[model samples]
Target: MTDSLARMARRWWLALWLAALPALATAWMPVGDPAWPDPQLALVYVERTLKRSDDGLILSAHLALFRSSVYRLTVIDPGADAETPRPTLPESFQQAGSVAGVNGGFFHPDGQPLGLVIAQGRRINRFETTRLLSGVLYSDARGIHLQRRAHFQDQPGIDALVQSGPYLVEHGRAVRGLSTGDPSQRTFVATDWHGHWILGATRTRLTLADLAAALSTPGALTPWPVERAINLDGGSSSGFFFDRGPDVEPVVMRPWKPVRNLIGLTPR
Candidate 1:
């Protein structure tokens, strides 16, 4: 082939490869184990750059894995149900002395909970029946879990809980008809249904449909496929903080606005 023609062909192939990269997927791989120096610790942090199944947009994710047997997960809120503002996730994580933390459920413009919020065993807000309030993440005798609002039977003696979201994933698949147009940074919780759950978020902005699609995709959560997931209050309220130590750089996304509550982990 003529030199110029061969060069043109090579350029065309390069363009095609570049176009395909957006659709290329990456697996959730752990950066380091014990996420801390403790050899006995069970928290495993994982991350990946993956395409949104709904679209080819790329996003990076950070997830902290927790097994109820090894870690204590809690949902916390400032005491008052009125006119409350909160520190950013990183600061709050340090203050709470948790292994990691992410912003919690939705709230009204008046700064009141939109659904149920039981923090530290105190009922901060009563449960409400609403389409958006579809998932409840709480700690009961069985331990921390995610339950569909329709199925959650509130009895007695709960430790912490945060009711949130439109139920992103169910039965190991993304739910149909998640809103797709608006994109923003997201914080979410997902479970494997056997007491293994994840606290995760992406600084990369993504629509709910995109986030749900990514979560349900294989290798997104690593080791455990998502059985169910719930979206925490996102947009400017979305944030996450995982401090490995002063030596290791923490994974964090600071919220631009004051978050209503936090879901965090501590040693079991």
Candidate 2:
């Protein structure tokens, strides 16, 4: 072939590949041990291994990472009335068009959210604070923000909010004075420097302090730097779920009991 013709063909091939990149990145893939379903948003689903402080191992803990800019974060509140019926995570997931979710906040025995529960721009439950429940997770025009309850008050334009936590990580460091013993299944929500959100849970048991340490250490479990982290309701309430679409069955770690609220991720 002539030099000019060869150059033209190469240019055309490059242009075609560039145009196909978006579809290729977002296409569904096999749900193996670690899966990258969405490349453009940098979403991932994987099981990770971590060592406990007492020289034990946490094998196959479920972890997921989703960029805030790519996914909308919202909370699902069953209702404010204690007598109202509550739905399971799978039910809530399908209702909200959520791809993944985890249990949110603590609750009363009668099934009402114990602390503040805000959904769809309205406060459904009143705010309460104790030694363990001190932080609030809320979404507004600026995105999700986590702060101490003492410094936060109900404000306008909040899309969703759930109050829970001992503030696992603060100011890029693991918060001191967390429980070092009495390990149990745990779940947490954390934010990276880029404002991306991470929802993760331990299949194996780990105390509050050990969980924070793993998150703070670079490359310990998460690929991003967790600027702030907060513990959700763990123990019997700890669970994680991800809907991988029609082709692949959903991934779910069932909670021991029905939960009052959940935090979910919806595609933007």
- Name the candidate that leads on TM-score: 2
Off by over 4 Å in 1: 1-41, 52-55, 79-88
Return the clash pairs for model 1, or none. Answer: none
**Residue pairs in collision within model 2:** none
Which stretches of model 2 miss by more than 4 angstroms? 1-42, 52-54, 80-86
Mind giving the per-residue lDDT tens digits that candidate 1 earns over 97-165?
A: 788878889988766888888876778878998889988888876678788999999889788888888
Q: In model 1, state the lDDT of residue 207.
A: 86
Residue lDDT tens for model 2, 1-268: 9999999999999999999885444332222343334534546776776544334455346777888777777888766464657677788887988889888889888777777788766677687867777899888777778888898977788888988988999888989999999999999988875756788988988788878877776656566678989999999998898887788978899899877788888776
Poorest 10 consecutive residues of model 1 by lDDT?
30-39
Q: Give candidate 1's TM-score.
A: 0.79
